[model samples]
Target: MTEPTSNKPFTEQTVLITGASRGIGAAIARRFASVGMNVVIHYLQSHEAANETAREAMRYGARVLTVTADLRSVDQIERMQDKLAQHGLIPDILVNNAGISHYGLLSELSENEWDEIIGINLKGTYLMTRQFMSAMIERKYGRIINVSSVWGISGASCEVAYSTAKGGINAFTKALAKELAPSGVTVNAVAPGVVDTAMMNGFDASEKAALENDIPAGRFAQPDEIASLVYFLALPESGYITGQIISPNGGWLT
Candidate 1:
């Protein structure tokens, strides 16, 4: 369909989502694909899973590409960029959804564990955004949507490292949004609450139910629900909304 009169048509634009092999990332790829938009799914080690996502997106006749790269390495990211350039798939929208979760007591957490969490969640977002944002700035029209967590807003107890990394993402979104605003590139973060993804595997059935009861909605959110919010933020109509951490956590946090 139709997009804002001021911007390119949805069919002509491309979206690149990092860590898109499964869960929220995959949901986002499918969301864009539903509208027949160009979709690029980036994964670290999920070749098969990425291909599966590509197949699903192809059902809507979207141009889909799967690229594997370690976001922690700039060299790999540069290679990924080169490959996309060869395919004429420069992204109009960049979703820094690639991240990892950490659950442990701060006392028990090793320095390496802390580094890994920050590297993937915070540093990876920074690297990916830095790599792709120049093209968007050149066009003076783009969307940068970060998939964060509600814990980022209200820190979690056992998930100190995860919370810290996501909190960094929240801050990054705010600061970068201002820098990119004059260029007509909007930057925002979607901090979702508990979702029914593998990220919740650490919690047992009883723990999950207890957590769900704590949420006003009485259930974990589905990945698609978060994807819907992301899709909205990427729209031309949402140009006015930037530098905001919009959390869809079923009223789990204000």
Candidate 2:
């Protein structure tokens, strides 16, 4: 296989992606690996799935590493940092793609449900960025991509928890981009309308049909399509394009 290109050229830069066992995360990992970029795929569980993704990424002749971390805890994140250092990997790009979906009446939601969703979706983003971002700042170059949802921009019925988390991510992207831009780091969000990923496992065929019908493009998005836009945003040419929430929804929401 032809090797994918590495975005971080000077150092053995790594792209750390959470929730990378499958779906959009897997696609993102493969895209970077195709260009021979070192990728660190993180997962909370699903060690098998994560390994599968790593193997696929390695096919492109790129270095692929896997780590398991509980996004809710700071100590686990710290351990992950140590593992990266051991591998001679310093992250230059980070993709905050780990999130959970919750669909139900807000009134019926339990406190634990709220915490889990917010912890993994919102808090994890914060922890990961906080942990890995300093290296980028020191190097004066970095890319941070937050995977958001169309619901984040526009609230979705029965999905308050998911929407809220994504909304927070959107805001975080904007705020952090400004904070890091002066240091030559760029932060952006990719808000996808709908993609055929396991996250949609909650939706039935009929519900998906309706969502597809509502979209002007008349279809759901593929993970690779989202990955392509992410790849573009990570490029050096994309330095001036920070603090933007870009949605590739096939004209669904717009």
Each model's C-alpha lDDT?
Answer: 0.94, 0.90
Worst 10 residues of 2 by lDDT: 1-10
RMSD in angstroms, all models? 2.5, 4.2
* C-alpha positional error of residue 22 in candidate 2 after TM-score superposition, expressed in Å: 0.3
| Distance from true location, Cα of 139 in model 1, Å | 0.9
Best by TM-score: 1
lDDT of 2 by residue, 1-254 (tens): 22223345723567888999999999999999988988999999899999999999999999999999999899999999999999998888899999989889999999999999999999999999999899888877788999999989998999999999999999999999889877888899999988999878988899989988989999989999999999898887677899999999989777
lDDT of 2 at 20: 95
Assess candidate 1 and give its lDDT: 0.94
Question: What is the TM-score of candidate 2?
Answer: 0.95
Candidate 1 regions off by >4 Å?
A: 1-7
Clashes of 1: 0
Query: What lDDT tens digits, residue by residue, belong to model 1 across residues 137-177?
Result: 88878999999999899999989999999999999999999
